[model samples]
Target: MSDDSSMLLDGLPVAFADGQTIMEAAMAAGIFIPHLCHHPDFKPQGSCKLCTVKANGRYVSACTLPAKDGMEVENNSPDLNDKRRTMLQMLFVEGNHFCPSCEKSGNCMLQALAYELEMLSPHFPEFYPDRPVDASHPEVLLEFNRCILCELCVRASRDVDGKNIFALSGRGITKHLIVNAESGRLADTDFSLADQAAHVCPVGVILEKRHGFAVPIGSRRYDVEPIGMQVERPATAGTPGTRDEQA
Candidate 1:
C-alpha cells in the first residue's frame, strides 16, 4: 500500500490526487471526516476545526492540509474523538441550539454531529447569550440562536451567488454573522430563497420561511439515520444516486 500517490489514514492506505487536501481525498475515498465549514462545492476554510486530525505526530486541519505521500494521518482515535466531542459541546453551549424546538433539528449539521459523536451533554455551561432573530425578509428568517459561524453562507453568497450579501464581523465571543445592507436587515438586502447562499447554511441560522416543518420531525434528514451514515452511504437508501455525488 506504500505507493507514491498514497497516504496512510488510520493505518489504511488512501490514494490522493494532486492539489487535494486531506479532507478532500478522504471524503472522495468514502471516509467521513466530521466538519461544519467544509462543503464539496466551496474552498476549505478550516474555520470550524471539527475535522482536526493528527498528522505526522502533529495536529492539522484536515480541511486545509494538503495530502502528502507516505504521511501518517490518525483521524479516528479515542483522544481525537474526545477532542472532537468537546468541540461539539462547546459549540452547543455557545449557541442556543434547542434541537427540540429548532426547525432544522434533523437537518442541522451541528445537531447531527452531536448525535454522531455521541455527545453525552453540553459538558460546558451554557452561555445563554441573547442573540436576535431577523424575520424582516419576506421569504427567509435569520435565526442567530442557531448560528455556529461556519461561514459557508458567506462563501456561497460571495463566491457563487455573486452577491456579497453575508459577512462576519466583531471578534471572539462577540463575533456574529451580518448582512451587507445599510439597514443591517435581510429585508434591506437582495437575498433570495433561490440564492446559493440560502442553501449552504449547515444550521438553522438561515432558513426559508413557510417551510419550517415541511419535512416533519421524524422524517427529517438526520432523524432517519445518523449524519455519518448519510454522507458515507453509497446510495440514497433506495434512491437513484449518491449523496456525495449530488453534494
Candidate 2:
C-alpha cells in the first residue's frame, strides 16, 4: 500500500522513514546497495558515487537521496552496475592498490566491494601515483598509495574526535590526504590509536602497525564470508562480530 510509506527498490517494497536515505532504508530492509564513504554515524557524502541508483527515472546517490513513498528505485541493474564497475576501475587505476601485499586485503571494504561486484580486471591503465607512507605515528601507518579519497577519516577526526587531524589537499587528481600540523606528520598531531578516525577507514590507507596479518590469511573478515553477506545481513549464529566485536 502507498500509505505504508514504502518505496520500490529493485521492484521490491522497502519501508523507510522520513529522514532515512535510500541506502539506509535498503540496509534496514535487508537490501544491499554498494557504497563507500558512507558510515552510519556520519552525514551522507556522495563522493564515491558507488551507490548511484535510478530513482523515478533520474540517477541519484542512494546514500544521500531520501527515499520517498512509492518511488521506483533501481539499484541492481546492468546499467547501474556497469557505471559502478567503471568507477571502481578508475579508483583502482588511480591508486596503487596491490591487494596481495596490503594488510587490509580481505577486510578492506574497497577490495570486498570489488570482489562482490565481480570486477574482473582494472580496465584503465594504472596511474601509479607516487604517494608517501607516513609511519610517524607509533601504532598507525598511513599508506597513501591505497587511499580512495573517501574522506571518512577527515570527517571522523574533525566532527567526531574534535582533533581536525586530517584534511584533503590539492584538486582533481592531485588531491590527497594531509595532516593539519606544521610538521605534516601524524605523530605531530594529537591523533591516537583509540581515536574514531583510526577505525573509520574502509581501505588500506590507514592501518594499525604491528597488527598486520593478526587475523591470518583465509581467516580474515571477508575471507570466509563476503562483505555484503557480513555487513548487509545480520549475523545468524557463530559469526565473529555478531557473537563478539571485532577490533
Best-matching candidate per lDDT: 2
- Residue 93 CA displacement from its true place in model 1, Å: 1.0
**What is the alpha-carbon lDDT of model 1 when measured against the actual structure?**
0.83
Candidate 2 lDDT over residue span 66-147, tens digit each:
8898899999888998899899999999999998888887777788888988899999998999998999998889999988
Compared with the true structure, all predictions reach lDDT values of 0.83, 0.84
Q: Cα deviation in Å at residue 235, candidate 1?
A: 14
* Candidate 1 residue-wise lDDT at 229: 69
**What are the clash counts of all predictions, listed in order?**
0, 0
Candidate 2 displacement at residue 198 in angstroms: 0.3
Please provide TM-scores, in order, for all candidate models, with all chains considered together: 0.91, 0.93
lDDT of 1 by residue, 1-247 (tens): 2335988999999998887999888987888889988887778889989999999989999999999988899998988889999999999999898888887877788888988898989989999989889999999999988888999889989988899999999999999889899989999988986687877678888877887876777876678778786654222113353221211
